[model samples]
Target: MNKSVALTGNEAVATAMKQIEPDVVAAYPITPQTDIVQYFSTFVADGQVKTEFVTVESEHSAMSATIGASAAGARAMTATSSQGLALMWEVVYIASSFRLPIVMPVVNRALSGPINIHCDHSDSMGARDSGWIQLYSEDAQEAYDNVIQAIRIAEHPDVLLPVMVMQDGFVISHAMQNLEILDDESVKKFVGTYKPDHHLLDVKHPMTVGSLFLPNFYFEAKKQEAEALERAKKVIQEVAKEYAAISGRQYGFFETYRLEDAEVAVIALNSTAGTVRGLVDEYRAKGLRVGALKPRVFRPLPHEELVVALQHLKAIAVMDRAESFSTHGGPLFNDLRSVLYESKERPVVTNYIYGLGGRDLTLDELRRVFDETLEAARAGYYRNRVTHLGVRE
Candidate 1:
C-alpha cells in the first residue's frame, strides 16, 4: 500500500505537504527550509494542489498570513529556519494565543551572530515556551511522517494549538535517505477534513479572534492554554497510534533504545540519535550496558514518561546541540534534570553541548561520552555536570 522512495528531508517534508494539501501555504525563503516551500510552490504552479500559496516578503508576514488563513477556518501551513523563525517571534506567540491550528515545519539551524547557516536546535529551542506543540525528527522519514501527523494533532478540538515539526538543517534536511511514502489519497483520508467549530468567517457566530484579555481574565485564559497543551500529549499519542495502523510505524513521546536494564545511557534528539543508536550497538557488542533515548515530542515535556524510563538508570548524558547559556547546561539538559528531580531514585546526569554550527559529532567523541557516563555510573558521581564537546581547546 506504500511506495519506497529516496528523498532528501526537505523533499520528504515537501512531499508530505503536497499530500496534506493544506488550504493555505504561506512562507518566506530561508536556507535548508527554503526548498520545502519551494518544492510545494511547484505543486501549486503545476496544479497538483489547489492550496492558496502566498508569497510573503518576510518570515513575519508569512506567519501573519498563515494565522489569518487559519483564523478564517482554512487549514494553513508554513516553514522556516534560523533567523527566519527568530523574525517571526512576535506573531509566533500570537498564533498560539489565538489558538489557531497552524502547522509549521522548521528546519533547525543555529541562530546568527557571526552568521552561520548550519544545523543546531537553537532556533526552535528558543521558542519552547511560546505555546506551540513541538515535534523533533531524526530523519527524512520521520520528518515526512511528523508533518502529516501534525495536521491531526493541531486541529484536535481539545488541543487547538500551532505545531512546529523540526528536522536538523543540512544534517537531515539536505541528506538523502530511503523512506516509505503513503499514497496521496491515503494521506487525505487519514487527515480527513479541517472543519473548525469557530472562525472569523463564521458570520452567524461573529466573534473577535485577537481580543485583549484584561488582567482578571488573562490568567484563566492562559491557564486554559496550558491545559490544552497538556491535553495535546494524549492527542499526539492517539494520532500516532492511528498513523501506525496505516503506515506500520509506531511513535511515542520519546524512543528508548535498549534502555530497559541498561545502567548508563545517552539521551539526544534529531539526527544525532542515529549516531547514538549505532554506538549503542557497538557498546552492547562489547558487553557494556549502554543505551540511548531519543525524544520525539518536546513541547509537552512528557515529564512523567521520561522519568519512568530514566529513573532506573545509574547515569545519563544528555546531548544538546544548542547552548542555553544558563551556565548550568543546555536546554534539553536542564529540562531533563528538572524532570528527573521528581524521581525517587534519580540518575547522575551530565550535559554535553555539541554539533553547533554544523560541527560533526564523530563516533569517537560519542564513545568517550559513553565511557564517561559508564565511569560515572560505577563511581556514583560525575567529574563534570556540563561540557562543550568538539570545541577547540
Candidate 2:
C-alpha cells in the first residue's frame, strides 16, 4: 500500500530511512542536510525504528563511525552537505577503498571561500573521484526512491562500494512536493538484509580491514576498487528493476525527455532537470526538436547509455550548477564531452555553467540556452563552446 503525502526532500529521505531501518546511522548536522538528521533522530527518540543513532562531533568523525559500523557487518548510513562533506574527505576515500557500502545523502552545496551556504554541485562533484556511486534526484520522489535503492546497490556483493544519493540543497532539499510513500513492509522486503561476506564481528573467521598498503599493493587495491565501481553499473540496473517492480516507478542511468527525434538537447542534473523538462515541453509543443537529458547515476559515467541517448542530436548543451574552475567547462559537461569523443555519430556539445552559490537560473536564461543550442545545431559551430549562464557579464 502506497500513500501520497507532501514532503520536503530532507523529510522524504528521513521517512525512507525510517522504513528501511538500517542497523546504524552516524551523522553530523550541516546546513540544508541538518533537517534530515534532525527528523531521523526524532524517530530514534520515539522508538519508531530500531536504528541506533549516533550523533558525532564532526563530519569526519561521523563518516569514520559509519565506516566502523559497516565494517562490523552493520548497515550504516549518514547525511551531510557542503563543508561537512569536505571535512569527511579523507574517510570518503577510505570508505570506498575499503568497500564499506556506506550510504550517504549529500544535500549539494557550494564549497566555502566566500562562506556562502547554498545549493551547488561543488561538494559532491569534488568527491567524484572518491569512488562512491553518485545518484542525483530531480524531486522529492526520486530522492526518496534513490536512497532506498542505494542501500541495495551499495550492499550488492559484486559491488561493495559506498553510494552518494544527492539532492540540490534548498532547491529540492527544502522545497515541498507530493510523492508516493511505499508501505514499510514492501520497502523492507525490497531492500532485504545487509549480509556482508566478511565482517569484523564474524568470530568464526577473524579478518582484517583498513590495513596499510604500500606501493607494491596500493596500485592493485585501486584497480580492484575501479573494477567494483564498473560492476556496480549492472547492479544499479538490477536493483532499479526490482525496485520498479514493487514501487511501479521506473528509473534509468539517465532520463531522455523528447530526445528520440530531437536535433538540439540539454543535459542537466537534480531539480534543474525539472525546469529543463518544462522548457523542453514548450519547445516540443512549438514544433522545435529540442530535448533534455537528466543523469541519475553520474559516477561510472554510464558512457554507453549516454552515447545511445545522445548520438542522434546535432547539438548538446550540458548545464553544471557547480564550476569546475577548469576555465573549460563544468564536471558534467566535461564528462559528456569525453564520453562522446569516440562516438562515430557525435553531437557538437557545449557547456553551460549556471546557478553557482544559489544564484537564480531563471526560465528566460534557460530559454536562451536552448535557443543558442538550436542556432548552433543549424550553423554546425558554437559561438562559444563554454558559457556562464545566469551570471553577470
Candidate 3:
C-alpha cells in the first residue's frame, strides 16, 4: 500500500535509500547533503535497516569508498553538494568510463570562489560531461521519486552509467513538504537488485576491469560507452513507465504545463521551476499565453522530446543557476542551443542567468522573465543566444 509523510528533499533521499536497501553506503557529511547521510547513518546504528554506512574523511574519500564498494558488486550510494561534488570530478569520470552504475544524490549548490553555501547548478554543471546521467528534480516530491528511479536507470542491463539526482541546495533540499514514502517492499520491487555482470572483485571469476587501453583500441571502448548512453535515453522512459505502474505517479523526460498551444514558455529545472509555475499561473489567469516546462532529466539531452515540446512555442526562456563563465553563456543555455541546432525551425531560445551565487529571485523576477520573453515574441526580434536575467551591473 502507498503511504505518505512530510519529508525534506535530503531526508527523502535517505528514506529512499532505505527502500533500495543498498549493501553499502559510503558518505562524508557536507552542508545540505549532510542530513541525508546522517539519517542513513542513524538507520545504520538503530538497526532499522541492515546496511553498512562507511564514514569517510573528505568528500573525495567519500566517493572513492563508494567506488570501491560499487566495484565489488554491491549496491552502493552516496550524497554530496558543491565543493564535495567538485572534489569527486576526476573519479566521477572514471566511474562512467569504467561503467559502474553508481547513483548519487547531489544537493546542488554554487561552487566556491567567493565562498557561498546556497543553491546553484555550478557543482553539477562542472561535471556535466563526465558521462553521468543528470536528472534534475523540481521539488521534494520529484526528488523522492527520481532517486529511486535513478538506480533503476543506471543499472539497466543495456546501460551501465552513473546517475546524479540533483535537487536544489537550500531551496528544495531543506524545504519540508508532503511526500509519499514508498514502502520497502514496493521500492525493492521497483529498483530490484544490483546484478553486476561485470563486477571486478568477483572471487569466483576474478575478472578484469578498467584495463589499460592503447591509442588504437581506446576509440572502440569509448565508442561502446557512447552507444550505451544513447541506449540509456530510451531505458529511462521505460523505467519511468514501470515506476508509474507500481506507484501510480507519472514521470517523463520533461513535464509540460500548458505548453501545447502556448506562444511563450520558460524552461527551468530544480526548485525554481515550482516558483516559475506559480508565476505562469498568474500570467495564465490574466489571459497571458505563457507556460512552463520542467525537465525531469537533463543529460543525454532528451532531444526528441524537447524539440517536439518546444516546436510550437514562439519564444522560449531558459534559466541557468550557474555561469559557464569562460564560454560567456550559461551551461543550460549552451546545452539547449546545441540540442536545437538541427531543428529546421526553432523558437527564439534565450537564456536567463538567475539566482546565481545565492541571489534571491522573487516573483518579480519570474514575472520579469515572462514579460521579457513575451515582448520579444511580440516584436519578433531577439537575440538567438544567451541572456542575463535578475543580474545588474
Candidate 4:
C-alpha cells in the first residue's frame, strides 16, 4: 500500500532511511544535506529506529566510520554535500575497493573555491570514477525512491559497491513536493536485510580488510572491481523490475519522453529534466519533432542502451549542470559524445553547461536550447560543439 505525502526531498530521504533502519549511520553536517542526517538522528534518539548514529568530527571521519562499520558487517549509510564529499575523497575510493555496500544520499552542491552553497552536479560529478554507483533524481519522489532501491543495488552480491543517490541542493532538496511513499513494512520487504557473505567479524574466515595489494595482486583486484560494476547494470535492471512491481513506477537506465519518432532531443539530469519534459510537450503540441532524455543512472555509464536510444536522432543537446573544465565540454557531454562515436549514424550532439552555483535555468533559456537543437538537426551540424547556457558574458 502507498500513502500520499507532502514533504521536502531531504525529509523524504530521511523518512526512507528511517524505514530501511540500517545498522549504522555515520555522518557529519554540511549545508542542504545536513537536514537528512539531522532528521535521521532524531529518529534514532526517539527510539523509532535502533540505528547506531555516529556523530563524527569531520566528513572524512564520517566516511571512515561508515567504512569501518560496513567492514565490520553492519549495514551502514551516510549523507553529505559538496566539500563534505570532497573531504571524504580518500575513503570514498577505499569504501568501494573494500567492497563495502554502504548507501549514501548526496544533496548536490557546487564545490567550493568561491564558497557558494547551492545546487550543482559538481559535487557528485567530481567523484564519477570513484567506483560508487551514482543515481540522480529529478525531484523529491525520485530521490526517496532511489534511496530505498540503492540499499538493494549496493548490497547485491554480484555488485558489492557503495551507491550514492543525488538530488540538486536547495532546488529539489528544499522545495516541498507531493510524493507517494510505500508503507514502512513494504519498504522493509522490498529492501530486505543486508547480509554479507564475508566480514571482519567472521572469526571462521579471519580475513583482513584494507590489506596492501602490491604489484602482484593490485591489477587483478582492480580488474575484478571493474567487472563487478559491469555486472551491476543487469542487477540494477532486475531490481528496478521488482521495485516497479511493488511501487507502480517503472525505472530504467534513462527515461525517454516522446523520443521514439523525434528528430531532435535534449538530454539532461536531475531537476532540469522536469523543465525539459514540460517543454517537450509544449514543443510537440506546436508540431515540432522534439523530445527529452533524463538519465537516471550516471555511473557505469549505460553507453550501449543510450547509443541505441539516441542513434536515430538528428541532433542532441546534452545539458550539463557542472562544467568538466576539459576545454572541450562538460563531463556528461564528453562521455555521451564518446559513446555515440560508436554509432553508425551519429547525431550532431552539442553540450550546454548550465546552473552552476545554483543559478536558475529559466524556461526561456531551455526553449532556446531546443530551438538550437532543432536548427542543428536541419543544418546537419552545430556551429559550436560546446556552449554555456544562462551565463553572464
Task: List candidate 1 segments past 4 Å from native.
Answer: none
Q: Each model's TM-score, in the order given?
A: 0.99, 0.99, 0.97, 0.99
lDDT by residue (tens digit), candidate 3, 95-189 = 88888899999999889988989998999988888889999998888888999999999999898888999999878888899978778899998
Cα deviation at 333, candidate 1, in Å, is 0.6
Worst 10 residues of 2 by lDDT: 338-347
List the candidate 3 regions with Cα displacement exceeding 4 Å: 383-385
- Maximum-lDDT candidate: 1
lDDT of each: 0.96, 0.94, 0.86, 0.95
Ranking by lDDT: 1, 4, 2, 3
In candidate 2, which residue pairs clash? Answer: none
Clashes of 2: 0
Native-structure RMSD, model 3: 1.4
Worst window of 10 by summed lDDT in candidate 3: 381-390
- Report how far off residue 283 is in candidate 2 (Å): 1.3
For candidate 2, what is the lDDT? Answer: 0.94
Query: How does residue 65 of candidate 3 score in lDDT?
Result: 84
lDDT of candidate 4 over 1-393, digit per residue (tens): 999999999999999999999999999999999899889999999999999999999999999999999999999999999999999999999999998999999999999979999999999999999999999999999999999999999999999999999999999899999999999999999999888899989898998888899999999988988998999999899999999998998899989999999999999999999999999999999999998999999998999999999999999999999988888999999999999999999999999999999999999999999999999999999988988999988
